[model samples]
Target: MGISRRATAHWEGDLKTGKGQLSTPQSGLLDNTRYAFSSRFGDEKGTNPEELIAAAHAGCFTMALSAKLTEAGFPPEALDTEAQVDLSMEGGPQLSQITLKVKAKVPGIEAEKFRAIADDAKQNCPVSKALSAVPVALEAELL
Candidate 1:
């Protein structure tokens, strides 16, 4: 069986000066949240697609890392992951890179083993697989 989720976006006006709203009906976490050109390209106080993608990648990779650790007999006590998505517009608008930073606490696990599992998780996570075309880098620390 396959699971599905949905979110909707509404935009009004042109691309440069346009305003938009995004919402996730099922979760309602984003209830018509605002996003615009300035918000995405400039440093404006609103959400952007890259930011949302980073958040989703972070969450998905963290869960995948947890599952990998558990399978390796080193269930994590805690895992903190941050995913940074880089958007470049040199040639055109493109998702250039994604960097993941992970700090994990797992008892009785050596740093080498933990790093190995984390590497595997980064390579095989659903989100990572989906974004395989983008360059992905990981900096994992066992704490």
Candidate 2:
């Protein structure tokens, strides 16, 4: 069986000046959260699509890494992953690049093995696969 998640967005007005609200009904993490062009392209204190994508990517990759490391018999004591998504507007606004950096603390795991596992997690995570059209870079550090 496949699991599904959903979010809804409501917008009013034009692109440059329109205001929007996003909601994740199931989780309720976002209940009519506000977003706008100013938030996305300017210095407005609100959430935007790119920021949400970054959060999703970071969370998905971290969970995948945990599972992969556990399967390799080197469960991580700690795992910190940061996903950065760059939006470019050279021609048009598009996701240009995604970078995943992870720092892990696991006992008895060689650096080489950890790197391989981190790379695997990066390559196989659902979010990474979903964003495959964009260039993705991974930096893994074993601590």
Candidate 3:
């Protein structure tokens, strides 16, 4: 069986000054929220699209990396990944770039081999494939 996730967003007012709320149905948490162009352009206390993409990219990349490691007979003890998504306002919400950074601690793996594994993960990751139009860069470290 396949698992599913759900989230909902509600927005009000104009784009330049609107406010919104996002909630996770499974967790019953109303944690996600948004407000105006102000935050993206120049303010805090609000969420933006790039940040949300970063979250998704981070999750998807980590899962992909883990799968790759397992397949290569070197399953990671732990994998820490972060994604930074850049959005260009000039191009109207275009994904300018994505940076993926990973730190993995695995037994019996050389640093060079680990780096190669991470590169494979980055290339074959579903999120990376989906964001193929945008540039995806990776930095992997074994510790």
TM-score of each: 0.98, 0.98, 0.84
Predicted candidate 2 versus true structure: per-residue lDDT over 1-143, tens digit per residue: 99999999999999998999999999999999999999999989889999999999999999999999999999899999888999999999999999999999999999999999999999999999999999999999988
Off by over 4 Å in 1: none
Global lDDT of each model? 0.95, 0.95, 0.82
lDDT of 1 by residue, 43-132 (tens): 988999999999999999999999999998988999999999999998999999999999999999998888899999999999999999
Estimate candidate 2's alpha-carbon lDDT, on a 0 to 1 scale: 0.95
Those runs of model 2 whose alpha carbons end farther than 4 Å from true positions after fitting are: none
User: Model 1 reaches what TM-score against the true structure?
Assistant: 0.98
Each prediction's RMSD over C-alphas, in Å, is 0.7, 0.7, 2.1
What overall lDDT, based on C-alpha atoms, would model 1 receive against the true structure? Answer: 0.95
Q: Arrange candidates by lDDT, descending.
A: 1, 2, 3
Query: Higher-TM-score candidate among 1 and 3?
Result: 1
| Number of clashes recorded per candidate | 0, 0, 0
lDDT of 3 by residue, 1-143 (tens): 98888888888888877877777778885466654577767767777767777988889889988888888898889999889888787847687889998888888888888888888878887777888899999999888
What's the CA error at residue 39 for candidate 3, in Å?
2.8
